[model samples]
Target: MSIVVSLAVAVAVLLLMPATATLRTRSPSVLPAFVSLPSAPQLRNRLMHRLLRRQARDSRRRRSLRLVDAMVCELRAGLAPRAALLAATSTLTEPLCPRAAAAAALGGDVASALRADAASLGLPLLIGVGVCWQVSESTGAGLASGLDQLLVTARADEEVRAEVAGQLAAPRATARLLAVLPLFGLMLGSSLGVSPLGWLLGSPGGWAVLAAGVGEIAVGLWWISRMVARIERDLMGHVKGAQPR
Candidate 1:
């Protein structure tokens, strides 16, 4: 009897799990990630992946700063936030940057649109869109002033990114040069019939040189990350400014 009772209780708990999840789903605070719409159940996860890819692509092609400035300027033109976003994006000469405008016109959720758009990558734009949508939906706040603030943040973020890119310009070039420098030296030594293994394993002096090179490599990476983060702080500032509603 005791064993049967325990099994019954275990089954009962298992059954309640789904119910509990349903209840928790209704509460955004309890959810770990952003809430998903019924229209796209897997949207949040997909958006996150898209956002990561956008960040990666952004590093290679940095052309959106002017686009952000232009968008912000339009936002400050006393237009509705959604309309401004749509109109500004429609002016994009690129294939990807303008998608956000179409998404805006469709009244899609702001967060998802910004994250998934390949031609655009910034935490602030997403936030601004979200806040603007929520405010417009709930109450007619001073949208023009809100947009001015958003534009300022967007510009500041771009400036920070530009500064960091500038800072990394020299160091990144040096890193590439250093990476190939040793290979050339090794090739010269080999051509001259010098024993490469003697330097690789037999010599304490060579080992020390290798260690220093490794350390410098690490430091170079750290420098780039710190520079990017300083810019990211401005990016996140804009993002937070637009949080849910």
Candidate 2:
């Protein structure tokens, strides 16, 4: 009788064990926790970084244009090419100014030095300057007139680019809004107690869906950005190519 009772207790305990396991599996704490997303500070920092980079690029372009205009003025005033270049460097800062001055003073390949400096600064206008210098050196042609024309064309190109950028502003904003719409929707659902994040973090199907959605968003943004950039580059290239070589 005692052995039979003992066996019955053991069987009961085994049955309870599965129930306990199931309960543990279904516990609230057992749900996969969502990873912490980037906080506001991190997002702000990223935005600041982007803004700084854009400003730096704009500043570099502006400085390069100014250098070209200054050189044109100095050249028109009857200074030699090397003298005009060195004078232009007076208004500018390193590394272009210092490098250019050194090259000019050293009596080395001034055009080549200018080209190198322009390349390092990512300034396309300076390429025209180098070309002007090279032509003057090789053929004894006047550089002042060419540089003046280049400056005029460059200004015109900048105006056109500004217009293009203005036109693109709306599209860019729309793309950004679309990229963030999913996040807003998720937040909305969460506010309504729908537990969207919980679902996304907790289940295999949800994980797959989330991954696909994120990938689609990223690819779409990348494609749009790439297309716009390519178009801008093509347009700029066409303009540059049309300029007097």
lDDT of 2 by residue, 22-134 (tens): 22222354223312223234444666898898888788787878888888889989999898988887888744545667878888888887788778878888888889889
TM-score of each: 0.45, 0.71
CA lDDT, every model vs. true structure: 0.54, 0.72
**How many clashes does each candidate structure show, in the order listed?**
0, 0
What is candidate 1's lDDT per residue for 1-245, written digit by digit as tens?
54345445543553444433322332344233222211122323454787789776664233344445555677677666677666665665664444566667787765456556532454445456456556755786765566566666656655655665675567656655664454555555655788663564344554445446545655675676576567566656665565444
- Minimum summed lDDT over a 10-residue window in model 2 is located at 30-39
Worst 10 residues of 1 by lDDT: 32-41
Which regions of candidate 2 deviate over 4 angstroms? 1-54, 230-245
Candidate 1 colliding pairs, count: 0
Return the TM-score for candidate 2, rounded to 2 decimals: 0.71
Model 1: per-residue Cα lDDT at residue 155: 62
| After superposition, candidate 1 runs with Cα above 4 Å error | 1-82, 95-123, 190-245
